[model samples]
Target: MFELSGQDVGEAQLLVDGSRLEALRGTRTCARWRWSPGFQAGETEFELRLPDGRTRRARIVTDADTRKLTRDDFDAMVRDILEDTFALFSLSPFRRAVSRGAGGPVPPIARLEFLRTRIGELEQVVARIRRAPRRRLRAEEAVLPWHKARHATGTEIVRSFRSGRVLRENHQPPRLPVQLRGHLPELIRVRRRTDTFDLPEHREMAACLRSWRDWLRAVSGRLSAASLPGSDGAAWAARLQALALRVERMRQEEPFAALPDAPATLTITSLFRNDPTYRDFHRLWRDMNLGIASVFGDFLAMPLSRTFELYELWCYLRLARAVADRWGVEGDGVSSLFGVDGAGLTIASSSLVLSAGGGWRLAFQPRYAEFWTRGDGRGSYSRPMTPDIALWRQVDGVPTPLVVLDAKYRVDQGLADALTSTHTYRDAIVDTKGGVVNSAVAEAYLLTPHQPAAGGQFETLPMPDRLFAPDYHRAFRFGALTLRPGMQAIEVAASLDAIASGLES
Candidate 1:
């Protein structure tokens, strides 16, 4: 599978060194190797050229088990990767202490937290409504029998269809007795009411909670709808069922009935009327909508495998921890370095600044978007240039050198592209008001899954011992480092140790 020959059992010529060797179905030979084609990793198929101008298709398999993948394994890997990603930054030192909750996995607990938090907020609103049902004292005019009036004014006349008699009269032209038939403002107590609900907030809150509850039920019901994969399949299904039951209970305790037949405009301002409770209601509404959209709607359908795009995210998080540790910081210190930015799990373009003392700081930008490069020298962007990870720091608001790291999910045939792109990344120059400065892309690295050392062709790329030389004037180049997906954390830490130590020295 690692050769570039065309013949089934016979010999063929190599592309790189032009040597001849036997081509086997499941084995590799040095004479049949061509380093020029480069190595491709992961689940990709490529064709190898033959001396007779024919091509043979081959697939590169990295996982030991190439059989059908199970849903449980997929879910577990997703959860593991995401958990590691979130651990890169804690919300606050006392977030868990104060809120009785820590960060959660992107898909499962995080999504659940969103639901729980929104529900709690809605509950508070319900409490407020129950405490002070919105009401108003209004006025209306009506002709009533004078006896019903507690204190009626003078009446100008009282008639019995024959003759009129003054029940009470006053010398003042406008001042009549209590028996007067003149119109008067009657104060009426009007309690705000919808169907069984009073305020529009009540109706909207009920509708929102009902929708969320329905969504939860639907999701939970899906557990029995199909057979799930993984060892935790039954357990996960049970958990879902339990959550559904809880939601059912919550809905049963629903404070407000369904919305009225007539529509009501439920504005936060009208609901709380500048009351502090307005914040709670608005925040809950926003969170409920966003949580549903981001978690269940967006993230639920994502697949977990070597092919997932989040592989880069996982890599960046692990690398961040490794880099911090390599800088002589561990545990809380490492956590603080990245958390200084206060942004949480920004997958593509996350920026962080670490104060390293002595007027020095270390800044990192993962999936750095502002890194622009001109690949073909045409005075225009020949191709898009965004390094998977970029590291740099400024002292006293002035720009310094930068280091760019790229995560290559597969590096066999893609290794050449990674190398070429990384070099172009090296040439990226940034202009500042102080002056136009070369980004001084000091070092560039291509991180990929570890192929066995027996396959030596991938490791031949040039890497300097001193990646971040104190001199900072050396020409830039990329080094190929291997990572193990099965043991992601260990491999990532090991790779960063090698890369960061070189850079720091």
Candidate 2:
């Protein structure tokens, strides 16, 4: 909620994000307006319209509570959750699409930063591998003159004796073969130790390096295709081209050139396990294979203004974890959370459904449309309502919405306003049969970072002790749950358990 007042303005209207705000009181020159920014964070624009046809503009920077979680902490949490989500998506059909540039437009700053850092590390590793590549003494067969042959095995000598050719060159002094009176051959087959870099491990390393170079080139091409003139993306694409060129050059040099393609079956040697260079190479190669960073590059590019959306996603994942903890996930439940579309692979943000044991299922942003006149089903009595998270239970072959949780990235007074939606959700959403209407949702709650006694207007609603009390949920199905970043899994589970207990009552 925000308040704006201007001098010498008889009657003024306040607009936030281009939407006019209703004044709470005192409209002339000192009107107080209430507006909930919701999850929007960053610079917010405010425009005030005066009665005299004059306009005043102000920009205010809004941010989350630093005491709860900093921006860096928020970004890290988002990355971690996205990594987990990508891991789950890898098992679904969308994995192939994700590999084929499904991540949409490359985010300039985050993509460039990732490429820069990873390429730097790869350069160092390639240099080290080049300096000391794995090699072995391979026995090589060669035909040499008798005088030059240092060691010849009996089998080789016999083979050379059978296939030996006489040297026609005239020497000042007779060579060893001529002096031996035809017992020694002029040319002999010899076996010598030679350092060869054709080991299976080296082949595997070469394959990994080639894969990296190709992936970098592909990403660079994508950036170039989407880049505009003099844009940051164009600059990033240039930088990526340079990095890709460097990798290509490194891959073409020395041991990599001598190595064959990676075999269908390659053994993992002890050197790969213990050697520093080999271990680093293996680890980095595995990380690149996962494609967690590249596949979800758009996530890291998200702006702070969309922090609320990120928070909502994080909340859903955390809630799913809590639900899984309470009741084990059903078969392939985790993999079912993702779906593939023309946009590539993405979490089913609008209509994801996850099943668990005990006939429980969790849904993400399922809509309850108006179906009041229709027979027995779940829907809203008035307008369509969609909650961020909904918990359902299968009862008599029907999926019944038991709890609805709306994640609001607001605290204190903003949270209080958010709670009003819960009231509407609990009352308007209903189960109808033959024109009979009853509440479809047992409990509806606003999930926020608001803690009791945190010094805000929330004190007027409920204190910490009473708000979190299990009995409180039973008495009032509509309330608020404190869920913020950095909360332990156990703590989140406990908070969710409170909701379950309320439903049981």
lDDT values, one for every candidate: 0.44, 0.66
- How far out, in Å, is residue 43 in model 2? 26
Q: Backbone clashes per model, in order?
A: 13, 0
Off by over 4 Å in 2: 1-117, 124-132, 150-183, 249-258, 261-280, 292-343, 355-358, 366-388, 397-505
TM-score of each prediction:
0.38, 0.54
Q: Write the per-residue lDDT of candidate 2 for residues 31-106, one digit (tens) a residue.
A: 6778665433444567778777877888887674533334544544564465556645543444354543425545
Runs in model 1 deviating more than 4 A are 1-80, 97-218, 222-301, 326-384, 395-399, 429-437, 452-476, 488-491, 502-505
C-alpha RMSD by candidate, in order: 21.5, 12.4
